[model samples]
Target: MDVTYPSSLALALFSITLVLALFVRSLRSKKTKGQLPPGPKGWPIIGNLFQMVMNRPTHEWFHRVMADMQTEIACFRFARVHVVVVTSSEIAREVLREKDEALANRAEAYSIDLISHGYHGISFSAYGEGWKLSKKVMVTKLMSPTTLNNTLVSRTMEADNIVTYIFNLCQSGSMKKPINVRDATLTYSHAVMMRMMFGQRHFDEPAEDGGLGPKEKEHMDAIYRALDCLFGFSVADYLPFLRGWNIEGEEEEVRGAVDIINKCNDPMIRERMHLWREKGGKEKEEDWLDIVITLKDDQGMPLLTFEEIRAFCKDVNVATIDNTMNNVEWTIAEMLNHPDILKKALDELDTIVGKDRLVQESDLCKLNYIKACSRETFRLHPPNAFLPPHGAREDTTLAGYFIPKGSQILVSRPGLGRNRKMWSEPDAYKPERHLDDYSRDSMGVSMLEPDMRFVIFSTGRRGCPGTKIGATMIIMLLARLLQGFDWSLPPGASQVELVANNSNLFMAKPLLASAKPRLAPGLYPKIQV
Candidate 1:
């Protein structure tokens, strides 16, 4: 005779077994560890999982809980894992700098795993030889000073194109049309990254209005979709058994976004791989794809697998666009609201780069006030709520609290910037605060703040490798816009409203501003496809 259990009975049995296992583990943890960080006591088995799931935007919830508790560090458990959130720079330094080696690993999550193609890329890959190899390639080949210098033409071309695009917008209507700061900035960023990655601006024909083309629009939409889902609070991430159940529909969304991204990227990658391996093409590297595809191991074999190349390409696309675009948009909006700041930035541009020419990458070194404006935006309006959580590889002690192995260390981006302890009137947009008493020639401004005052590009073993490129892109984008046109609040709008999106830190509304060409007509380069 065969004995079978009903579905409900099986679920009930599984739940009971899970709770008992957790109870046993908790008792063992209590015996071994000193004490966890301060936080609200969660239910026995679930351990704040419900609260996390119910929270619409989990970062706000975490911030509120920590605020109410009056603590900079807080721990909340989800199932068997401990999630520690850090708001203090001292503790942030402790996690990212002092104990960097132990906390270099990234947390394992369903969404990131899917987007990264099973940890093939550096950003989401587990800490090990594979991650080391990927980073080495990224730093040495793709983002090296040599490569950046070589690719200067591509970046410069896109910068000129944006000026031309905006000039056309200014000239198109009965009066000058209001510029969509967000769209123009996004296009400029997208075009630059595409030129560096694929050696082309548009996947298909270029947009008639110097905006995103049909294929490019679809591709960017998918990329933003993927980003929206990435690192989101998906219930299935903590409860592995519920993964395929499609609870909250996150899995399906990620899969669909990844599919769209792969569809756009994989074909180009495969075609290039064939050219290198089969046809012996590309004697000189022209783009980042060539650098990645042609890299070889000591044995003279391709260093990265096909999946690794694809994953790296996808990682570059996602990482480069959003933060740079958002920061520029926010900076412009803030400047429009505070005309004094706007005038100061324009004056600096006029002094450094006269109206006869556009701002170049070389000018970035001396543009201290402009760089400070960008830094201020980074501090006040970070694109994300938290840096990707760094997972602890072994049990460790941090700030006198017992941290278990595999505990996720989440550093709050907004928290560090807005901490009253760190800044005077932290909530206000004060670019002057970042300005220092250093000469222009001797003092070069950078997006990185090594003291952990606020993270533009994170620092440490697993930190971002693209800081130079990121800073150049950000400053150049801002400089060109400021030098090329006179920006003002659109007619009938008294001031730019600085409200943030409920779900994310993006401006609640895309900034609309009026622009008039401030430079000679010949200064704006003719649009080139």
Candidate 2:
């Protein structure tokens, strides 16, 4: 019994509403046109995706373009995505501090889902109560100063083992055989982390042939494959329509690697749980694994399920081992390339930590020069060239630019570290620049502060919680290595290549060097706990 309207009338009304909506949108766009940061004009639809990918690598290209345009902040478009790259310390501070609340969470990524176990870990979890709880547990149980102090014995012992292992190699032929610096550091880092986290060592003994056994290699390779997925840009990441196709097969590869890692790690976790339950949960906590399995929340419920525990532990393993190893290697490489600097570091080490005993954790605070060297290395080669992608949680403004909801934010660590305005002789490696004031700030030592001038550990709410432990690890290892051995490029290797590989985030080329013992022969004995 209703009155019928013609189809044409309904169509006319719909067309009028669409026209009005478009009119309002154009007006809003016009108001903000001049406010956006200067950037290259992109083609319609695809935007600058093709142009950026066709040019130099994404990080380098952005640096070059920002330099050419003389802009601290630049805006660009990639398909439907809006990207904002900040290259100045001032703007970085604004984004990371002033607008930190709106930009703390990471942009959506498939890898976060696959690798972080549905964003359960601290690094990739969404910014909310859950992330807060998880982070609280990590800070209190694992990264607290008291806990680090308790583990000092284990770390120092590991450092001693490394020196002993190197000495063992030298007994056969000395500097005649070049040692793989990367392999040595990686082994040391992994072993120490295993002991601290699980209360056990991964490797029982050196293989009969004195190389990593098959099982050991399998476990290490699985971790490497899983972490490698974090680097570079992927088409599936930017475009949602192509995710199902798995065009590059990244998803499948990640899944396989995760399976392998879980296979290797699950049994150890199960054993720990079994022991805890057998004791009616009365066992005193000794390590990170014990803490995660035993800690409870406000409601008297366990803070994490078994799966969540595994995922969080895995995050700690990947971040702690990978970053510490890479940072140490880069610092050494810098020293090798600059012999004068190497001599300076050695002078500092020799003066501060003598050959009477190995460098201990207590010695790190007094070694300011060594700390400077680590800072310079970070400025030059931050483990992550680009900080993890930050997104605008709501419509906001950054440096007078109109950043709509869902705009991606990229803070270029290498770019800002090398910025000419912020530093004098930014391209050159000079540790003395950080020596102006020897006082400690938020990051412990002068060199380790969380200033926007050099964001090695980033800043604000999402800053790396492991900074304190990480700084201690790098300084301690570097001090010990330089104190115990003199390093140089192997024969026929004219120079150490500093060029990075595009395949991964870390140094592309392996660091191979000849090591000659610099300590007294009598000091080479194994350290007794």
Candidate 3:
């Protein structure tokens, strides 16, 4: 009787589990690539998704596939969607430069829509008038030198605060404790971008009112999740016929992410608009929000809805801000790795900036090594390994291959940064590559424009409009930090093996950097030149 009862209970549990498993399995059905693009072979229903993501630096695996295929560019099939892997600078130029107008548009992927609130922002918007107008507004009005200077003042103020925080942190604990440079950089950048767009960096002070508030942090977290998940093979993105493929928790994550972003940003936008009405002066006297709000000539139509304004703010905050900060962090890491390069930069900076005054825009000209270090850093670790996907507005062909309308075109930035064909000793961190006076002359620019082959900020119409300001910000921060302290890898840290494995954030950062303070008398001292 006991044996019979136990067997019966086991059979009941198995039956229940099997039924639930079958029900869950029924939720998804695989689709065919048909005429999409040529790529690696994969398992059914989930095609090529798992293999691409199983490892970090997702680009490396794809690079190996490119190597095996003997092709500079190839396409991968994720269910039915096409993902093109580009690995050449000439092809990159064709996509980003020559035929740019025909290729300036972005693919309307589902995850971007959810993370970006229905693809409403400029960074990921489809090629159209709205995107064009917003991009122009940023380039001409918001990202101008005058506006950047105003933002710089805010940045300097924040930097001073950061210095105080670091000093206090040192006083309390071991100064050698390695802080996540990504977090610190974000703190710096969020403050700058906030001031640029909204006349403030954060909603409330973290120390006084709590860092970014719990709600704000949650919202920022959603933004981060949105960024982290923005690009990847999503089953739901490809097999739309099956509207519910929760592979790797991607579907649920993106939907949850959208709700999080809206909750965080929508309220702030509402309050900002109300404040603008009450103040009733130059709506755009000092901020991007003011500029858009002040526009009476918005074609006599409602110029911008709160949704559009929110998208604009998100574009600057989420897209470009972190890109600049991460670039700075990577530069710092690379310089630390190469001592000779660091010393060269210090000597150059000491000449121009001296030891008592801060680095100024005027001094950027004489500080050649400092500028070279910036280029070398970008060479080592570009912000976006792959440029954002650009959709073909019309059908085009490259190398006797047809690129149909909607085919995704991307500039292989990371690969290009490391290409031996374009760079000598590609993996080695050497800033002297740009120091050739002839190299600088051949480039037909000052220390300002870097080697075009290393397109950290990209090029052409879609190239980062804020490139100059972004570069200046990185230079200033690095100059200030280097002047303030002689940074190095922390005790017992592997200097050689320390690679930036920051594949998880919106911008890639150095996952490992250990150093203690080497306080100097002056931070960002005056440039003697």
Candidate 4:
């Protein structure tokens, strides 16, 4: 039988034993040779766990503590684990770049382990040969420039579809009605990923208004739920013995979301695998699924196992959807609040792409101001408060501080973007700040920030491999929306509310804005199929 919660007597006994064990270990442990970063003092056994618990959103709490200490880097201990939080680009580089080899591993967590199929996926896997092989396959076979270029037609089609959808929404009522920017952006991002992955947009019938169908909505909802649980801080992660107890209900939520995701994805993957193995592989590769399925090793056998393929599919789905959607949503909201910025972006698009045609991926190079707006959004409002924590593979010194083996190094997203030392008036949103001394040919605006000023796509050993495609998707989405239509706030609202959600960095409320077609009637492409 499974016990959801322990009996009072049993719980009391366990707590006593845990405290005593920790006390004894603290007394017996030897002092380290070097200094650790400064942080708040804690109780005997629990360390800073209670302080963290009292703080509702842990990321905010961490930032406040670091600010109070007036330190760029700080450390906190949660049941013997040393978590080093970095708010400085210098320290971030020191950990992720200078000592990359020594800190290449990923910290083990319960939700990540469950979702990744015991670390079978690339993103959260431990640093080892398995990770290397998976990254090589992902980079070379799926996300390389050559492959992405080959798949351009699919992305182009979705770009056209977004314009068509928005045009339809604008025309629905005699007068313009407020459209849900969040819904439209999510649908577009989802459609692009689906077309590239499965060669089709919908599992069943398509929604008439270019929104998600029932099946698509269910699948996307599950994906977001899984992301929330994966990034959330779990008590069981700190206390390994309480993993299955479901004390916080995180385990159950993760299991349910994973079940939904598998139900939607596994059948399709299995059917395709059967088509390749039982029947014969397709004569022509149609989509990414075919490309991954047809990959062969030196001995003329399947390169990856079924589990690995499924895990990869899931990873791509999770990674592709969130950042692009959130960035576009945030950018649009910001522009509406600052109409001057919106006008500047519109002027740039009109000057480069012209009003006679829709913005194409090829036009992205010349649109420096548009690219700056995107960069500004990334710097001000990242999707997550922190990048996924990088774990240390061995004991090392970082910025003259001793980092014990198994320590987790967290890079703050807002901390770097708003670091007073790196950016002047860091809290303000100014796209021109990125345009200073910017050259379209030499620098050529893209989502990557190699200098570690602000992270769009990270760098180093465990950096994102899909930067080329990712940059294309972001720029295209924003460009099309700006080029094809005119956007404004709803009737009564004076300005867009830029408050971020407590759990994550997404807008607390979905953005509702009025849109009117800004181009010739013939410009918007009709939806095919």
Best by TM-score: 4
* RMSD in Å for all candidates: 5.1, 9.0, 7.7, 3.3
- The reply for model 4, stretches above 4 Å from the true place, is 1-30, 440-443
The true-versus-predicted C-alpha distance at residue 488 of model 1, in Å, is 1.0
Could you give candidate 3's per-residue lDDT for residues 1-529 as a string of tens digits?
0001234333443454356446557676433334434568875544565565454346677778877877777776554345676777777767776788888787665677665566776787877887887787778777887877666666676655454444444445677776555555655566556667767655655444212446556656666666656665444455454335554456677678778766656676777677665555552477777766654444765466776777777776566555666666777766766778778878877777776665565566566677777777766676555777887787676544667666677566666777777777898877777677435345322433333576667677677777776766666666666665566776787563445544432233333455444555345222110
Clash-forming residue pairs, model 2: none
Question: What is the alpha-carbon lDDT for the whole of candidate 3?
Answer: 0.62
List per-prediction Cα lDDT, in the order shown.
0.85, 0.74, 0.62, 0.84
lDDT of the structure predicted as candidate 1: 0.85
Question: Sort by TM-score, best first: what order?
Answer: 4, 1, 2, 3
- Name the candidate that leads on lDDT: 1
Which residue pairs does candidate 1 place in steric collision? none
Instruction: Judge candidate 3 at residue 247 and give its lDDT.
Output: 40
Q: Write the per-residue lDDT of candidate 2 for residues 423-511, one digit (tens) a residue.
A: 98998889878776565543435545556887667677777888878777777777877888879889997778886655444678778
By the lDDT metric, which is better: model 1 or model 4? 1
Q: Of the pair 1 and 4, which is ahead by TM-score?
A: 4
The C-alpha stretches of model 1 lying farther than 4 A from their native spots are 1-32, 437-441
